[model samples]
Target: MFDLPPWQSWEMFGACFYAVRINALLVLGLSTVTLGELLPGTMMSVKTRSISVELLPSRVFRCTDTFGASSPQRISRQGNPLETIDWTSGDWIAVNDDNGVGVDIFFTLKEAATDNVVVFVDQRKRQFGKFQPCHAKDYIDKLSVCPDFLVARGARFVGGIMDCVSPSNLEKFVVPDDCFILSQAGTELFTALWRIIQRVRLSSPSTRHAKPPSRQCFKAVRKKWIKSLGKL
Candidate 1:
């Protein structure tokens, strides 16, 4: 009963066959797979009865059981309980430029159930972005002081108002250069962010790039952002 998605059916069968071939009778007997189905008229429900076994490529075995709960109960290869994560659709924030004109968007991919931020995404362009695994506080600090800190190592822009209109600013917004490689989950989150930004731009292009109402407004937003991230 190696239940898996339609796409992974072959992979699951392959793993099962390999296990049998390797004479892992104990593993094959202990392993069970349960496929979940949504019950009609329910908000969201999973009907699960037993434990599931996942065989890693290295042949390490892990078991997970949810028993209809939202969080899984995992057992490592050593038979010790493992931590669980419930990742949800994440949120985003928009940062204003130095002169308060133009905006750069950042996103936090988080696990809502565990209150963890897996990574921070900095959207440099429509097609390019970077994900930093640092703590939210550290990332925000670097972003506030120098938005280009990740891309530009030593270069620092001078002047106050002129900085907003600098060609470098435009260049940063448009240039699709080097980008960090993303895991499958990270790629999904990035695609979600792109869709959200596109919708925002379509609804109100000017508002998407508009300056903050006031410096106080910017501060208020930043404070709220930090407070929300503090829980992560």
Candidate 2:
């Protein structure tokens, strides 16, 4: 449920759980949202494009036979695709591989240059079988698709700025009322992402010089979504 083209697809909802990155940091989403507060230092680590993290309480568990994960807390354990379309391509991007790792763990390739902003979804060998280039409108009900994962207990979704990961210092990010791009952090994050997209399309992929957030440098960039300014 987390991956889809934000400009297109079911992901028109702005940001999502899958397909995330910011200043080179990967995103971690959770389906088990908590109404209560979690303690500090709680985290879940991922082995992806970057060694990303997801902060959460230990009440949740990973999606494996064992209750273990990188961090002490239980992992929700789960969780996108596309390329060469419009910036607002109303669809999410992903890559297909029959013998690949899986879309839930897929990341944008450094060399798979395309003329469009793309999200890479690695189709799992056992689940989706092989990946197909699709969009939000396609709305395939196949396993590991965005819609299904969003509703899945342990899976996380990926998409746009909404699909970014939180620093270890912050709590697990919960999507705000309108999504956070209007805030200072959101503005910087997406602006950088857009620049990266442009560079990639031009076949000159290089990230901005911004440093990752340190504990002292971190900022909670939450913002209220406003329907008047635009459509999600």
In model 1, how large is the Cα lDDT of residue 196?
Answer: 36
lDDT of 2 by residue, 99-178 (tens): 22213222221212222222223221211322122311121222233333222323333321222232221233332221
TM-score of 2: 0.19
* TM-score list, all predictions: 0.17, 0.19
lDDT of each: 0.24, 0.24
Clashes of 1: 0
lDDT (Cα, tens digit) per residue for candidate 1, span 70-188:
21222221133353222112222222221321112222222223333322223121212332222212322333223332213332211011011112212122111111222223333
Total backbone collisions for each predicted model: 0, 39
